[model samples]
Target: MSFIESLTLMLALMYIASLSYWSGKKWGAVVTLLLSIGAVAISLYWPLALALLIALPLCLIANKFAPEEFKTEIKINTLREGCQQLLALSLFLVAIQYCINAIQLKQGSTPWLMRPDVVDAFLPIAGGIELKAIVTLNLWDQTHPAAALMLAAVLLTGLLCKRAFCGWACPLGLAGEYLYALRKRFIKAELAPPAWLDWPLRMLKYLLLLALFYIVIGMPSESIPYYLQGNYHKIADLKMALFFVTPGLITLACFALILALAAWRRQGFCRYLCPYGAILGLLSFASPLKIRRNTQHCLIEAKGMKCDKCTRACPANIIVHTKTTVRSDECQACMRCVAACPKSAALGLSLKSGHRVSHKGLLVLLLLALFALPLTAYLAGFWHSQTPDNIRMELIQVIDRVGH
Candidate 1:
């Protein structure tokens, strides 16, 4: 691994540990912010790692340009959230594009993978040198080399942006959000994450991580990619195919169950069953962005709009009314409170000021993310190297009907 990458892993690990110790220490968040900036800088910025020189101010602008009331330091009138929602109407667009391409004159299924088609459009990055290739991950085929870096990228982004990936980038999150909208329309249950169930349930996602590892480690190392390479792919070796095709409807069912939980208790999936949410929730402890309060200016003093609205509107169920300080790392930086605050003084993400975060914990997360950098990369490459027998060179001759 490159020294900088090693340094990054170290920093990410330290960030994780510090979160465990202090949970939401401001210093830890600061450290994470710096490290995250540095990682991106070194990896993508080249010789200077000067991305921070640019990024920090942008984040400040994100905070300052947040909304007028938040910037005013005086009144509260037009605080209608500016954080853009990352909802995907792309599914419909892609579906439309597919219909246009259909050779079929008439078919019930449209044979084009109509409306919410499973196809993914290529996303060029690094000046189009790299791309987000289309992908699928069902029960049989699992690990996606094209996706691991994407996952890691999201994981790393959590440090500064809070849950921006979930709030802004993840298509699955959009799906979940849409389901949630449908849920509110059909049912009204204020499900609470009961203390007994809440903490235990969050462990499920990691268990899922463990399950993924177990499935991967058990498969023939050579055929891993074929299993993960997505649908109708030739990788359908008997054992791997059986395992790959395994994720089942239970996956959707799981979301349905989580949605049901959220309907009853707010953010039930995030608070409980989502592994990514679990990691984000844990790492979020070090997020530089957060919801803050000024107890002195708080509504509890006058009992009007000061703190009531921010706390009430917080979908995460964080008690913003009570938290005068940016103490909880679990905040998503969703800016919901920033928008909802009738008294803008009640919430904002601070860069310099906050309770002290643990510098020691920062050290730990740095070490870990650094270590995982190459390890995860190697694993990614390793998984990809294991080609499936179904993908045999000889088979191409049989299918394409041209001489090999």
Candidate 2:
């Protein structure tokens, strides 16, 4: 985007943030503010950065002086949706920038636009390998350090916030949501697999995760440097982009299956295929935050009613009402159940001590934990790729021929 366009987006975000704060959706305001800051910082527009820095203090002041009514709790579902939309847009822009850089390199010219290093977030396999290298050999990946940083950030998020990343930030999850909505339009009832089938299907992701770990962990430590510095690894992101852009018949068929399964069951891809999500789901077991049920406040226990709204509202098909504490890996921490409950106190995301973490506070912590890596990495001069532009230009030309 041009300077004028970026400035307009920043100002628009700030305006929406102000409106969100005034309307008592404080998390929405905070998201917009953070997005604006990220936009300026990534683009390295110091003037706009100064503007955001100034506006941030003012926003904090406004929030502090706001009336009690304006501090009302944000609906977690709404906050998740807003976050999904913003992140979708951000990723879209990154894709555009990445393609533009590739095009520039293909034309044998230096890219005028700075490459968006965040694109490395897609290279989880590379990141995993690099992480092993870091642990075993004290070697940092020069080609895609951002990948490792992103991996750390996501792992930290999983450790602290469950699978909120999948619920709120993953683009694939956002796409699956629309597919789910479309499914609901045609099928009035939920279509879930029986336990016999569901259990095996869910194991697919874990098995895939194990296969990935086997390859990464089983590699001789000596070969780590060779793999990281290989030409194929240097253009792995471009190779990934091409996989979607120029998918073969098998790739298309796999996509068809994914869409059909997602329509048939909620979060089917995350549940059955995403190795990254499998890692997060496992780590989330150690997270202090979980959805806790209060029998004293619940309609099922307190009023002897046959209410199962929380269970019905769950996209993950978790029986939220049956469990005093939701410990299932399938739980995305989306808080759909909490929002669906008739009694406000019946369901909540709480620590072990029963101290409820407010939705706003959760958003703040999740975002901070997730972004902390990129911010710190950037400050430490480790976020961007160290690959020279001339080498990248040459590599893009033979990207098709380069292979593992």
Candidate 3:
């Protein structure tokens, strides 16, 4: 996007976010849906006839779920009930964008992947938190800055609202969640990742985090972007082609294999493998906005109803089910538990206006250090930018190994 277009989007989002924050109207959600629609419309790749599907979000506006969070609660109106569905609908429009690209690729209408013009940041890739941060720090200049800021805003919202963006803002995550709804019927039960496996999986992201750092800090910084730029082609394009033709098809095969694992373990990939999620989990810690627990009205003193639904619905397997108060980094703020609790167990989301960050500066510094460490590594020659020709191949192999 150009400077003016970028400014317009930022102002629009800020106006909408603040409007929702202050007025407590449903307009915030509406604006969010509109922006997603606007994003789709901006592409203009979709058929004009498809605009008729405005009914998708229209239906969502009618089905909003009540909040019902506490004893005297601020329940969402009808619009909240179908927020997820509307979000999914908006994202489905984005999938249309992706499908257009795929179609263009097949028809020889365009050379997309390696084509700097069509490839780079033009594709529909969102919900990757690390990618967001990297772009924020200007690590990926090729990325659309407006989109990056929009993503950052969404991430900040998630920090404040507990993964609200995962369910509401992220186009890609919406696709996954929608697919999971269908996949769930065929599966048995959801299990938290086991300690041994889960522990190892957590390291994968942390390691990938460090690897990104090493490439940035330890490698020659000038060389790093070339590596990233080239690898963008390899992963997004070369890999797509090789998926059908290569002997090293295990990587392509892993996509389905991971989904199968998710069937057994709900959000297994999200829980343990997503580097973007790991960063958010870290940054969100110091987020002044936190979920407030209504300790006085909790379940231990009450009857039949307790905190069963929130934790049960938690993809992160947050242990809200057993606790009077729970504030783990793993919480996604999906609001399943908030909406699911029978007694309205006093669990409420809090909009923190201010807090004591000075006392927590050490931890805040740690998060910053964690972020800068990767960039330093790129400039310093610790990453895999040693050879430009093979950097793309190497990064994929690295990402595949670590992402799995």
TM-score list, all predictions: 0.49, 0.86, 0.56
The local distance difference test score of each candidate is 0.45, 0.81, 0.45
What does candidate 3's lDDT look like per residue over 1-404, in tens digits? Answer: 22222222333343333334334556654764465456446545233114324434333343344232411133432223344454445334443444554445545455242222111222224213225337444474333222233334445554544444443444445445555666777764555566887778767766765665454355444554554445453354334433444545676677766565545565555555555556666666765555554555666454445446666756666777566445666665555566666555366555444231211221122222222332233233332222232444355445444221
Better by TM-score, candidate 3 or 1: 3
What is the alpha-carbon lDDT of model 2 when measured against the actual structure? 0.81
Q: How many clashes show up in model 1?
A: 39
- Highest lDDT, which number? 2
Give me candidate 3's TM-score against the actual structure. Answer: 0.56
Question: What does candidate 1's lDDT look like per residue over 78-166, in tens digits?
Answer: 21111112124433444354344232312222233221112211111210111112222222212223234434545675775556545
Compute the lDDT for candidate 1: 0.45
How do the residues 1-404 of candidate 2 rate in per-residue lDDT, one tens digit apiece?
Answer: 23322333344455457656766677988887776777666758664576666666665675678665544654677777887887788778777878888889889999987677778889888998999999999999989998998898999989998998888779899988889889999887978889999999999999999999898888889999999999999889889988988899999999899999888888889999999889999999999999999999999899999999999999888998888999999888888898899999999999989999766566666676666566556656687798888988898898889998
Of the two candidates 1 and 2, the one with more favorable TM-score, higher being better, is 2
